[model samples]
Target chain A: MSTHTEDTKDIWLDECFAAARQDTTAAPDDLITKILADAGTMQQEFATQSLVATPVRAGLFARVSQALGGWPSITGLATASLAGVWIGMSAPAGLEGVTQALVGAEAVIDVVDQYYQAEFELAGDL
Target chain B: MASIEELSDDALLVMYANGDRDAARVLTLRLTPRVFNHALRLLGDRAEAEDVAQEAMLRLWRIAPDWQQDQAKVTTWLYRVVANLCTDRLRKARPVALDAVEEPVDEASGPVEKMQDRIRAQALQRALSDLPERQRQVVVLRNIEGLSNPEIAEIMEISVEAVESLNARGRRRLAASLSDKREELGYVDAH
Candidate 1:
């Protein structure tokens, strides 16, 4: 290994530390001209994208699906949640008072239980 | 000084932010060649270097509006962009195998110019390849592209003191690794 000069801060080191850096291996100058010629390409792409990007009416299944995390998963979760909610809400009048209290507790339990269904074990599972 | 063309970097950038195509072209023209050189030296691949340079400039053009005059200097911002792009590429790439494939040139002929340029290029590559990534970066920024310590520090996102320290260590290591070929490298006479 070569011995180095001391970490001597100097005037010339400021100027001369790097090698002579004028690019001797020059590429043809037309490369720059061509790059300049292509300058409008990005703007044109942006314009085209804008032209095609207006929102359209969503399909029923897609709208349902997109309600969750695209469409299908969202639709299923919403259907399940609404079904459970309707079952709780449409119970008999006599049971309404009891059901209201039960429903409140059930809603809490349902939310907690469903929140981690993928993590928790199911009834028949080993 | 009088012409719109002679406006400062920040002034040109402000004009660019207002959608002045001329300002964009001027900035691109001013910065591209050096950015290309920096990226080329870092990646040791011409096409990749060009891509990185273009990407860096693209980012620059995008962010010109919000650029802080003091906190963000044009070339310094570009240096960081090029460095980050090269870093990303390096992460996905193994060390390149540089075949001795010379692009044919039609310029005035000399056996000495060809030999020396070839040797210099190869030697520079080997020397650079020998460096650690950070050290190589410091060397390239400080030496080849000829940015100052503060500017390099800003680009590298480090303190001025850190820049000094890194440059010192990098130069020391490089000088040691390259000492044997000191004469060949035109650093010092072997005799």
Candidate 2:
């Protein structure tokens, strides 16, 4: 082993590096088999999760709810619909009185008469 | 669906996480060689290097579901994992079996050049092993592995300046160590 000048030293180092880079060592076949085996096991685990964890297809109502904006919005719409149905079915006791107070009976009669008069005029024109 | 070769590593990992067995195969084919080589260079023991590569890949498989694509490149993350695994093995200083260090065959060169290349490679490995761990890592990543200094810094979790300093010191040491062997390594004859 003899020492080289600085210029030679750089060239030698570069040569050595180039040689080392060229010396590519593949992972052993058995090692690759082991790695792939492990990956296979993980794949199975992932498969199991896919099978059990995620639904294949969301239920129709669930899909609709998700499209509309998830459970919160669904719950809100449900509550509003239920309230509307209750209001329509049960007609709370002071509702008519409240309506009469808000709009006099004469006002209601006048509106109905005006509606019938417009219908009669349209029929005559036809 | 894109073929495995057409997909990026990140995409392969995502597919693997989603239960695509072929994706796992593709990823293993792509990354195992790099991991094994890096580990072998760091540990200087074939069996241990294989173990390190396997363990590192196992961790990768485990973390696939949670892997954040924007966070790190897959190979970079594997390099970091292998480096840490090598560090832990070095710290433990386990007695490597005598048969564990197998010389790699260089099929690309003719017999004589192949022999010479092997010798030079062994000499460089010896010099690399003699370096301080950080310097060795920096030099290997920079010179042999052909990674940029910033990439080396990211893998080693050090500042780029520190990585540069380590690389300089490591190369200087390697040059000093191998300078005397220039003739024996056929550097003079080749020149």
Clashing pairs for model 2 are none
Badly placed stretches (over 4 Å) of model 2 are A1-9, A50-126, B94-101, B108-111, B189-191
**CA error at residue B27 for candidate 2, angstroms:** 1.1
Global Cα lDDT for candidate 1: 0.66
Q: List the residue pairs that clash in candidate 1.
A: A2-B176, A65-A71, A66-A71
Evaluated on CA atoms against the true complex, candidate 2 attains a DockQ of 0.31
Highest TM-score model number: 2
Q: CA shift at B72, candidate 1, in angstroms?
A: 1.8
Listed for each candidate, the true contacts retained, as a fraction, are 0.10, 0.72
Residues A35-87, model 2: lDDT tens digits: 99999898788778777988578799889988999989989999999999998
| DockQ scores of the candidates | 0.06, 0.31
TM-scores for every candidate against the unseen true structure: 0.60, 0.71
Per-model i-RMS: 6.9, 6.0
lDDT tens readout by residue for model 2, B38-74: 8888888878899999999999999999999999999
Against the correct fold, how does model 2 do in TM-score? 0.71
